[model samples]
Target: MKVVIAGGHGKIAMLLHPILEEKGHTVKGLIRKEEQADDLRKAGAEPVVVDLEKEDDISEYVGEADAVVFAAGAGPGSGKERKWSVDRDGATKLMEAAKKNDIERYVMISAMGLETPRGDDVFQVYQQAKLQADKALRNSGLNYVIIKPGRLTNDEGTGKVKIAEKLDRGEIPREDVARVIAEILEDDTIEDVEFDLLSGDDEIKVALQEFV
Candidate 1:
């Protein structure tokens, strides 16, 4: 399988590259900065430089890939406008690209507990943007899996997780999230479903069994 990740240089995406490579899949990461290419290369992924916020049509960048992952985001410090551009619009553009390129599998790295918008104005907008993007993917009529993970941490991955249609607010390591994404990409049985993820007792494969 060939996989394209929109935020190639992101923390979770960087972790995911090597895992996908080890699974015998080709990986390409879409990066906004040219300098990020080396980092992606070291992680075993080819880097394609394309600014998601600026590109109206990114289908060419997406090219021929078996799957595309929407992992790009406006940083937490950015304003509400960027939230719409990078988070909502960027993700939607990827969905369009996937459809244009005939890519049936799209995996979205969304957030959990977005149904109730909270936080400051900017944060609320961010949540709203994510919610909109998730809705778009769900209605896009593609084989999609939206993994809504809780607060992300940098802790080491334990390879155990809890997945369900709705999970209590919690947190999980970025590494574990990447592991789950990798597993989902390989498991064709998991499609058109969204789930909340957190660190728990079940192994990665076992936790995903219910979705299969």
Candidate 2:
């Protein structure tokens, strides 16, 4: 499959690139800077410079891929104000691009507990931004899998993941989340279920397959 990854150089993308490539999938990394293109290339993915925060004609790039992944983010360097720009507006831009390109299968890495509209916690600001993005995707009339994880860590991949259809709790490793993203890309069995993952003793594949 030809996969277009927005934010392909992110922590999640670090693990995703190898998993997808190992499965023989072609990847396109949508980056914001021309310099980031080199890193994407080294990861075995073709890079395209696109600022997902801005509105533009994405028909060209989105139309070229079979699937799209919104892995792009504003990053920690981007101040708190960027929460809206990158997480909400940026994500919306990418999805709009996908819609224009006629790409239906989209996998998004979202945040946990953004379903509500009220929260003032500083960290929860990210959730506010993600909430807007998630709402847009839900109303986009497209097939999307929104993976919302608790806290992220640099722990090694345990190959075990816990998944619940309406996961009301838990945290997971970014690596395992990356692995799940790969699985969602390949499997058509996963319908329109929102997933919240966490690191546990259960087998990763099995836990994920449960949702299928």
Candidate 3:
């Protein structure tokens, strides 16, 4: 399998690259900066320079991939406009590229509790943007999975997670989220599934069994 990850320099994406490579999958990472290419290469992923916000057409880069993963974000330091551009518009554009290339499998690294209001003004707008992106994916007619994880921490992964259509608010390590993404990619049985993910006692593969 060939997997292309947007925002390949991201914490979760970097961690995920090795897992897919170890499983015999070719990994391509989309990065905006040329300097970030070396980091992705060290992690065993081929790097492609493509700025999601500026690129009008990305099918040339994403075409022929088995799947595409949207791991891009505008970051907390960025303003509200960038939130809509990178998070919302970036995701939609990837969907369009996927359709143009006839790639159906997609995994979205979305945030949890999009329906609830908890953050400040800017964060609220971020939530709204994610909500809109998720809506588009549901209507996109693509085989997709939306993994909405709670507050992300930098702690080491426990290799356990609680997954459900709706899960209470909680936190999970970035490593765990990367592991889950790799798991979902390998299992074709998981399709059109949207879930809230959090740290839990259940094993990753076993916890996912119920969803399948």
- Pairs of residues clashing in candidate 2: 6-72, 7-72, 171-198
**Cα-based lDDT for every prediction:** 0.95, 0.78, 0.93
Per-candidate clashes come to 0, 3, 0
Candidate 1 segments exceeding 4 Å error = none
Compare candidates 1 and 2 on lDDT and give the better one: 1
* Cα misplacement distance, residue 160 of candidate 3 (Å): 0.5
lDDT of 3 by residue, 1-212 (tens): 99999889999999999999999999999999999999999999999999998988888977688899999999898889988999999999999999999998999999899999777888988999999999999999999999999999999999999999888889999999999999999998999989999999999999998766
- Candidate 2, after superposition: displacement of residue 110 in Å? 0.8
Worst-scoring 10-residue span by lDDT in model 2: 114-123
Root-mean-square deviation of every model: 0.7, 2.2, 0.8
TM-score ranking from best to worst? 1, 3, 2
Clashing pairs in 1: none
Each candidate structure's TM-score, on Cα atoms with residue i matched to residue i, is 0.99, 0.90, 0.98
